[model samples]
Target: MSEFQTKVSPDSETFARNRKDMLALVERMRALEARAAAKSEERRPVFDKRGQLSPRERVSALLDPGLPFLELYNMASYLVDDPDPDTSIPGASIILGIGYVEGVRAMVFADDAGINAGAMTQKSVDKALGAIAIAERQKLPFIHLVESAGADLMRYTVELWAHGGGMFAGLARLSAAGIPVITVLHGASTAGGAYQPGLSDYVIGVRGNGMAMLAGAALVQAATGEAAQDADLGGAEMHAATTGLVEYLAANDAHGIEIAREVVSGLGWKACGPALPVCAEPLLPPDQIAGVVPVDYRTPCDMREVAARIADGSDLREFKPDFGPATLCLQARIMGQPVGLIGNNGPLDPDGAAKATHFLQAMDQAGTPVVFLNNTTGYMVGTASERAGMIKHGAKMIQAVTNLRVPKITLYTGASFGAGNYGMCGYAFGADFLFTWPNAMTGVMGGAQAALTMEQVARRTAERKGVEADEARLAAQRAKITAHFDRQSDAFYTSGRVLDMGMIDPRDTRAVLGFCLHTCQEARARQLNPNSFGVARI
Candidate 1:
């Protein structure tokens, strides 16, 4: 009886427009992901000559067949790598995501070695480190397909070199924490990259192709005048036989992948909890999500309409629905996971913030995970709102979100501007996982509002000086401010900067939520085997 009544109107022109814009954005997101794959594919010939499989092919081979591979940060370093829309190859020269490996879900990080020799950039390094953090926190095994040319010296910054050390540190930490860290060296992993396989619990190196050593023959000859072939110095066979570095040495790339899968399979890892309730798909079709949200978030639509398609059986039990009507707190089961979802039908007033604060604590106490659907234009501003203890109650909601021990997952379905972003568990608050729809935008405020505020300040300055505001100059300035905000607030651009995990297609929201929710809960239930140190070379 408490289930939300769907009020979606698919037949309306607004729905048609929303559907069209949303689909275009989703297509754009996919096209960019394809671009990264294409860039890697172009290097197939080079990899073929070396008798090595491409980065993505290695991932495909490593993961179990036909299961979901939830790719993370596909648009990573998108425009940041190369600003041009035609040429920016994102994903930091890596194909990284979470997928099932030999029936065990693991975090897979593969150097898209075909691109820039799978060179590590600032973004790429950060991405890998982020995945490792997830693995250690979520209890997922970490698998790395190593074949990196190391850091790009041409673009080197001291900060990047220093930050890149975290990748090796993360692997070491994973091993020490008893979360398996597996490295399959498909090709060269020299210099700083050598430690990647070295720190892992299990290292599988390919006999002819794989190489892992602190120094290569060129570097060794340059420093110490010791000239030797690559294999004799640091080849997989050498490491396996002489140094005790590699646990398994395979004949080639495919064989190396097989070894990695077998290593995971041998872990005998399983989910520690009882089976979840059966998931009956929502009554409202998922594709309808495209039509539910207007791309220009200023256009208002019921958040419940979107919720209907995401919650199972299209049921969302509204909590305190009468008070703080603009803020929605709903109890729902997403793929059998009990969740408290908070969404904004409008800006958060004092009442709304207070209500959300109470709801967050309830969910926390109940041990239920929370999902923040970011869409507010921040807490309400102006004289009336200020008098209502806006800041006090807003801070309480944020505190509750920050202190929550239960898993926090955030999704930016539309506009999330100002303090609303923070109050609703934005990135800085450390939501366990954060994702966005292609249409989502978040910032201090919307472009129009920002530009208008500046214009008002300019006009006020002129009025005080007893001079008329220059209409043309004022108009030009407003346009400039709006354009700057619009460009930076774009989902693709933000996702490129690693602002969110990735830009997801709106239709896949439900499935992605289920997977993430399950992952978080499983991690909480599973026990870890702690040790004194990471697997050492000695």
Candidate 2:
């Protein structure tokens, strides 16, 4: 293995500018995350008055102490509810992530009942489905902190109603796969929401607060002219004693979470496999990554520099280095876990595409996981490049990525444009896990190019119709299109919309990669006892 040498000049003007821009982007992300937290905090008084813990508080208390919790899609529905961005809080009235419960790594999600009475939204439903997909794929145990008023009818749509069934289907799938599904009802879980806990293998409900019913007392009386109390309808005590819906009844939120932890502890999950090879930290300081990647996506930087900063001991064995320099393929170890890495120094030419395809296949043959450090304007275009078979080669690369059996992880270090996104295993390619840098941008192409293309189309249409082209109108239209695309392509916008999980600081790249790699490895090694149907309550 050849040691990668760093050529980045930290004191250079360009590096300083890059560092400043990257830090500012990171700051913006932090502020947005803080805003979401603050919004949830605003309901603290209400939760306290009800003798319950906040959604975040419940999550914290449920997880093991000193364990790393990777929260996914923390900003799911930002700016979706209204026009004003400030008024829209992102989290989709839910909190979801992977964390340790009783030493067992599991997928845990909680209803943010503190927000909008834990009403379900389109994005929240998507986020929940995404979380469930991860848990199902990784064979991780599923845990839910159920507290929801169900779907909000005011803003509900037929699409949301139709897609809502997937949530229940996912729960059943997880249980059928022999992965335990645990639920703790901390508050209301009415109507369709009742199935969330009902489908779980184990359920714990808070005595005074927990409720799960198809219809509340008011609805029962309104429909049948029979007055009934909530306690008789779906209260925790009723479910635990008579309905056989809840397995355990707790006095409060803390007790419910405690019981959940205990249930996970009793699962008898196997321990993780043997550790990877011992390796030293990267010789290059990971902190330098902030300066290494320019904020401007157009500015070129060596992807190898990023490889060096993340690889253990800065050792990366280049594979066919001279054949295709732009698309770098290398073998390196992150935290002693060997991995094949594909990165970009420029657009994917025919040669680069072929090289990457070969590299992906070789890695799969070797049973090594691959990590994509994405940064490209996509495949090289134009008459010369197209003549060189760019489309054929790019398709081959995409095919290799799509068919690979190995776990694929993607990190958008910079611009991920055009089919380069697919070739590099973007979200559509079903990466085992995907994350982006605070400065990353993902779209079909840059905003400027898209605007110009639309402008040309409009001008050509006017000419074909024998009408004089309106130059001023075309210019104004182009400006609007450009601005919209630019805003939509921003990292904040993409991340908020759950484009690729969530954004991370450049400095934390190695640690995050190492954590995810280990997770994938453990999942691949573990075995499960599947049944024809999921375990059900009597």
Best by TM-score: 1
Q: Give per-residue CA lDDT, model 1, range 345-403, as digits (tens).
A: 99999999999999999999999999999888899999999999999999999899889
Per-prediction TM-score to the true structure, in the order listed: 0.98, 0.97
lDDT of 2 by residue, 270-312 (tens): 5575666688999999999999999888999999999999999
Give the range of the ten consecutive residues with the poorest summed lDDT in model 1. 1-10
Number of colliding residue pairs in model 2: 0
lDDT, candidate 1, at 354: 97
- lDDT (Cα, 0-100) at 225 in candidate 2: 94
